[model samples]
Target: MRAVLFAFALLLAPSAPVLAQALPYHIDPGAREIVPSLAAVPSIRFLTTADFPPFNFRDDKGELVGFNVDLARALCADLAITCTVQAWPWDQAARALEDRQGDALIAGLALTPQNGALFDFSQIYLMLPGRFVTPVAAASGFEPASLDGKRVAVRRGSTHAEFIRRYLPTAGLIQFDSEIMALDALSKGEADAYFGDAMRASFWLNEHVGCCEFAGEPYFRPDLFGDGLAVAVPAGADAVRQVIDYGLARLKRSGAYDELYLRWFPVSFY
Candidate 1:
């Protein structure tokens, strides 16, 4: 059955790109058929971390909830799939998908090459800038290049860690399990500054970390951050991957993607 479905998917794949570009609202015929089977496959789990709020986080009731969760649910609904959301430790989520413990990663993961080699990414659904956040007193006087010998906190296995390790090799790097913890380290003066996705950094600084403020202009590295966040599938899951990409294109053209983005983010971008 899987082979037959996959073969059908291949037959439909040739027209996907053209359809994605021409029609504002289109769904791959092949994907529509496979959608029903998704529910029966208990192996088709969605992986995410429980601590990353506003993106993917656990609510007070211990139910997984947030932007990524909602997006994942919506995507599954569009695909007519029953997707089970599971909380994997942050560092293990991607690995879980790679090992086939899960089918997809809906964690709003940035598309870095190192990751790209292991997984296929859906179309970029959201874009976020990276920023430097420091104590208010230190914000005005800080410079990215000046952190030569200072300690900087970044979430473990994050793009921030990738950036700092590559760009600020001379600086001390402290890897934390969560952004909240990294901010806490900064507040306690254990680290000179913390860096992360600008929107998340701003949200955290405004609501929780009052001691720090964002410094430096926001910039995104295509090499390190890629275009934006996407759902990642294990490499070679072409049929499932094509379905997701097609669904994403449909969502974008039909304005469903915009509506969802506005519902959660509100800020508009052309």
Candidate 2:
């Protein structure tokens, strides 16, 4: 499929030069810190699912590699603690954590109320916001408010579609079955702009090169888009959560987080 190939291409692409100036920092380096009052963490067991490429997946060499795996290593290094990241089927990952087989879940698990009952989540590290992409020529002039009669492409029944229905009601809504379909419509000029997950849009923009570019500010309605990605630790694991948060903040302060972001996402979404 075109989307799959695009993702593979993105993974193979050389790491781009650091875009920290343009990229937004998810964690504030200068924020007041609450030193976790806990015994030393000698080791950590991080559980993840491999099906989610770019986050956690097996490489052609059959070795575990991806942003999440690398991030786990970085976190461990930051704390000077030993850690093991293990992959399991998507369905089994949460259960493994529930069974005390892992210390934390690093995969992008949805932070829903149901899951909240079973786990405590770390501060969000990444948000998948909605963004608009238009033909390069139209990108400069594109404005969310000015799209009186313009067509906007989005995946049918997706949160992005609902966002358009509620917020940008004036624009004509064009729905597709998938993000790729919506992007394809935009590429052919069948739609004036395409609005969808910013991360996915970034990949398409990267693969298509000059076909299109991002326009306007990104929309981050967490209530509609779902809570951002966070590490999930078992219930009552406040100490573990605090430790992860400390490590994450340190990563942000040290610029290691930005380096990993650029290496994994050569095309900056923000």
Candidate 3:
């Protein structure tokens, strides 16, 4: 997710242009648009980092594994071309891709405005949310503005941190160095609430009883998260982009996407 001192989570790097505090969680199904040249592209080199789990990471056997890897394989199959999933260090990813070392990048990276000038990204397939987590008793029905004097905890310097400062300014902010620390603050009553990734919060709450529960709507903002995760390709690589779009569509249509999603993300972000 958004994991960095300067992380913008998948936007790890913008999430929302404005606060979309409430909206139905549905992505309309559509036909895949294909670029004829994608069929002619003999191979696709998928560049990704191995640190983002559930999306991209190395398994116990040291093999690259995760949603991105599976998707890359599926997209290659859709295009009827070979694809190699190569893991790269985070710092070198941009340079490597720009130098023509790889055809695409899919390490849970966001489609930021800055990235728009360097590469084109496929349609966003997944969007993580900024959520509020509070003790079950304290998780009363509330909205962002309702946290008038609540002390909220957050990972220091995360997109969610920024979201709270900008949107929930009335709530006091308690910054932690790590997610565990922030969550602990809520569990221990050191903080009245915790703001962060909805999916992660779901999984954590499900695992740790009496720890916390969802307190409000999941926030969706392009300026807050960047537009979710998409395949990044060389600029003008229309064929490659289209192929991925088509494959993702087929995956959704046939229920393969749901299956993979459950396999990796047992908890839903939405």
Local distance difference test values of all predictions, in order: 0.68, 0.83, 0.73
Return the TM-score for each candidate structure. 0.54, 0.91, 0.79
Candidate 1 structure quality by residue, lDDT tens digits, 146-231: 78999999989988898998889998999998777887898889999898766556445545435877777666676665576778
What's the TM for model 2?
0.91
The top-ranked prediction according to TM-score is 2
Better-scoring candidate (lDDT), 1 or 3: 3
Between candidates 1 and 2, the TM-score winner: 2
lDDT of 3 at 253: 70
* Candidate 3 residue-wise lDDT, 166-198, digit = tens: 877888999998766888788888998889877
Off by over 4 Å in 1: 1-44, 130-198, 201-220, 224-226, 268-270
Off by over 4 Å in 2: 1-12, 18-21, 28-32, 37-39
> Which candidate has the highest lDDT of all?
2
**lDDT (Cα, tens digit) per residue for candidate 2, span 132-237:** 8999988897789877789999988889999988988999999998888999999998999999888887777777888998898888889998778899999998
Residue-pair clashes per prediction, in order, are 0, 0, 21
Task: Itemize residue pairs with steric clashes in candidate 2.
Answer: none
How are the candidates ranked when ordered by TM-score, highest leading?
A: 2, 3, 1
